[model samples]
Target chain A: MTDTALHTNSRSPGVIVLRWGLFLILGLFALFYLMPLFVMLTTSLKSLEEIRTGSLVALPREVTFEAWRTAWSGACTGIQCEGLRPYFWNSVILAIPAVAISTILGAMNGYVIAQWKFKGANFVFSLLLFGCFIPFQVVLLPMARMLGLLGIAGTIPGLIFVHVIYGLGFTTLFFRNYYVTIPAELVKAAKVDGAGFFRIFWSIFLPLSLPIIVVTIIWQFTQIWNDFLFGVSFSQAGTQPVTVALNNIVNSTTGVKEYNVDMAAAIIAALPTLLVYVVAGKYFIRGLTAGSVKG
Target chain B: MAPILDIKNLYKSYGTVEILKDINVAIEPGDFLVLVGPSGCGKSTLLNCIAGLEPITSGSIAIGGKDMTHVSPKDRDIAMVFQSYALYPTMSVAKNITFGMKVRGVDQETQDRKLKEVAHQLQITDYLNRRPGQLSGGQRQRVAMGRALVRDPKLFLFDEPLSNLDAKLRVEMRAEIKKLHHNLGATMVYVTHDQIEAMTLATKIVVLKGGIVQQIGSPSEIYNRPANLFVADFMGSPAMNLIPAKTKRNGTGMLIEIERAGGEIITLHDHHTESLPENVIIGVRPEDIAEAGFRAGEDVQEAECLVDMVEHAGADTYVVSHLGGRNVTARLHAETSAHPGEALKLAFDLSKVSYFAPDTGERLN
Candidate 1:
């Protein structure tokens, strides 16, 4: 008899029970984690009366697109009365440039710290890593003043600038740690192959950076898109990001509380980040664990 | 022809700690120079310095008589194969072999031609489209060689390229590398901690220890006449057996007196004019020692000793015995009858022995 057959024949009843028990515990945790998202979807689909009287977990009796349309165009956010559409665009405009600039800059920083090491490179890296630990609230006043001096205060560019600066610490840390796992000999090999600094990064290192880039982009996109603090602090009503707009819509005192519209708007504001996670979640997890394992 | 590579008074240091001290080596057009030593011996550091990857603290490097001390590695016209076979992980084998050419703006036609040639030479054409991650260790190593071969650079630097391979594959690749060198007649400087690789592949071996060049010579020169005790001990498999002995004057010749077990004194005579030191080490290769009745010759001196252990290794048996209060190994013919605790007669070829000063570890004669 084969070893495989022998191993299969030796399975104990306790092992099967343990496996089923593990699945049961994990299934419970997954359902608990997804409960909020389920509640939001159901609430967004319900009419005002159904949402007011129905239990939070109950399925919508009559799903309607009216709330979605109102959330998309008719809702009020800070006297504008136009919904999250404009602010969603604002978040996009803010996040694309911010994520691009920060990720590129972080990749370059990581390359330098990992490959072109010098006497004080580690010290510089350590100092930069200290930025990741600093609370963003601590830098608010200084950043506002700096943005004011730069003549971009309360503008879209100002928000992008703020996000990039704040995001750089984490992005750089991620890229640096990931790039450190790559052998320094690769850089040496490229140099010997007549590849200069930028050329090597573009041809050699950049192609190998797909996993980390996906990781950094997804991280920065979610952080910037969902950011209420920086958006409210950096930009005023016209240029405010979606997160700030969503907050304004839910808390506006002048209008009657449209709970269904608010839930729909909240869902709208979260869709992009959700979409990103749904589309590239595998790459995200892979990137998170890329350099952790020794190759 | 002018030397293909020249390093003069090269010194590399990190802050206050020196890694390489005034290393000087000049290689001709087709010389295979192997920089070999134990770990932390700075062999890799020196290779990097030569490749222009590490900046030399002082002194200058020249390739084909062009000074390259301050030149960036890209413009230095050198190619290197790393021990990890640092092929670009994401690129296919074809792309990897052509990356250097692409960076230099070599046309696609020439790139294809050179790629095919290198792939064919390294027997990696079948794997041209596969990524480095998919290739086995030996195959990845060949791809690395293909990348370097496509460059056709003035000098090739190999940093322990075969150290990652299995022992069987390492032996195979070592021969293939030698064959490649014979075909190209390229100037190559390889760094490895494996002395067998150094002895087998290097036309000239530079033995290093503690970041200092211990000795530099041809393989035979290094083996037959090592510059110091370190090189003598390092270059051979099983290593040369160093028996500490006392040297004295015997008429016009010199005599080395070694004490065996049971108060047995064995004296060997050497003809040398230098003043004899009191305490010295007598270095003899393990293979030079044999059974007394086996391969007896004029220079062979027989000594009766107790065999402490015997290890059979197919064709030959390694017999361990006590000499001068230390274990000495002898490679005896497999057919010889020997066992532990048995009295045995061993022959030492005096002509093949080396003398060293015990205190300084320097070769005395």
Candidate 2:
């Protein structure tokens, strides 16, 4: 007989019980991750009166689209009312450019600093890494001043630049470590074949680096798209990201809090990145594990 | 053929530690040179230095009679097959093989023609459209070679290219590489730790140790005349039996007297002008010993031994026996009937022996 024969293990009661118990515990933990979003979705469809009188977990007796409708097109802000419809479009416009440009720059920076070695390159890498560990407030003043000097203060460009700069630290860290694990010989192989640095990055490194790129895009989109601090600080009141509008709507003082509209608007603001994760959740997990295992 | 490549007084170091010292070699056109050594003996480092992946500390490397000391690896016109078969995982076999041509702006038709020639030769035409991750290990390795072959460069460097294969596949691929070298008449330098690979593929073999070349010669020459004790030990499997002996001045010549495990004295024929030191060593290949029944003869030397065990492998029997408290092995023809713990007489042929200074481990010849 050949050495490649398959063998089966005899079943044991203790093993069977342990397997079932493992699945049960895992099922319970899965519910923990999902319960909060479930509660929020159900609550957004309930009337304010019903939400106040009813238990948090109970299904609404009267389902209404009033909250979603009000959140979308009708909202009062200190006597003037306009729905989040205008703000929703504004958020997407701000986010798409910010995410794309930031990711591209991040990918380039990751590729360069990871693959090439020049003098003081590690110092540059260390500074970028140092940027990652600092608090957001710490950079707000210097960034504001830098933008002020550049003639882009209190504009979308100002906020866009800040997002890209801050996002680079983490994105480069991710792509740098991931590319470091890639066999250096592949780069040498391409180089030996007459490929230049940019050509190597485009033809060889970029294609194989998809998993990490996907990961960086997912992570940076969420960070920049939902950012309220820079959105409030860098952008003017007229040109603010939708986050500025959402914060204004939710935190208005001496006004009646419309919890349902607030909930619906919150989901609207989060929908793009959340939907992205839903579509490419498997890739996120793959990217994380692939980057980690070699490390 | 004249030499296609020359490396003069090569040196390499990593920070404070020197990895290669004064490595010098010459490769003839269409010649296959195998750099055989243990790991960290600088074989791979030498190959890397030749490929321009690592900078030499001080030396001259010339290809085709032109100095390429500072040439970029790409400008050197050499192709390398890495040990890991470093295929771009995202690229298909055809794309990986044509990547070099594409980068050099060679037109599509020429690229496709060259690609077809290599693919057909390596038997990977059917898998040309598949990415490296989708292929088997052997297939990936073939693509790696195909990637190198498409360039048709001045020289080829292989860094332990077959070390990752299973035993059966290794033998098959070793033969394939030998055939490939023959068909192309390409100058090649191969690195390997496998002695069999060195013996089978090399027109010249360079054995190395601790960043130094111990010997460089044809396989028969290296096998018959290793330059040092380390080379002698490293060159053979079921390694050469190293018998420690004493040297004494006898008449006008020096004599070597070895003490066997059972307190028996055995003399080896001296073949050198250097006076044998008090401590000398004799190295003999296992197959050089045979049965002589403690005979009474001038040329035959005998030692009585108890057979430890016998391993019969179809065509030969490997008999492990004890001599003067040392384990000595004898490879004999297949019909041996010696049993364990039984007394037997083993004979040594004097002409096949190698002598060394036991203190320095240097060969006396």
**Top candidate by lDDT:** 1
Tell me what TM-score chain A of model 1 achieves.
Answer: 0.93
Every candidate's fraction of true contacts kept comes to: 0.93, 0.76
After TM-score superposition, what is the CA distance of residue B362 in candidate 2 from its true location, in Å?
Answer: 2.0
Report model 2's interface C-alpha RMSD after superposition on the true interface residues. 0.9
Please give the DockQ score of every candidate, comma-separated.
Answer: 0.80, 0.69
How well does candidate 2 score on lDDT at residue A281?
A: 80
Q: List the residue pairs that clash in candidate 1.
A: none
Predicted model with the maximum TM-score: 1
TM-score of chain A of each: 0.93, 0.86
Superposed Cα deviation of residue B93, candidate 2 (Å): 1.5
Ten residues in sequence with the least summed lDDT for candidate 2 chain B:
B293-302
Q: If scored against the real structure, what TM-score would every candidate get?
A: 0.94, 0.88
Interface root-mean-square deviation, each candidate? 1.0, 0.9
Q: Count the clashes in each prediction.
A: 0, 6
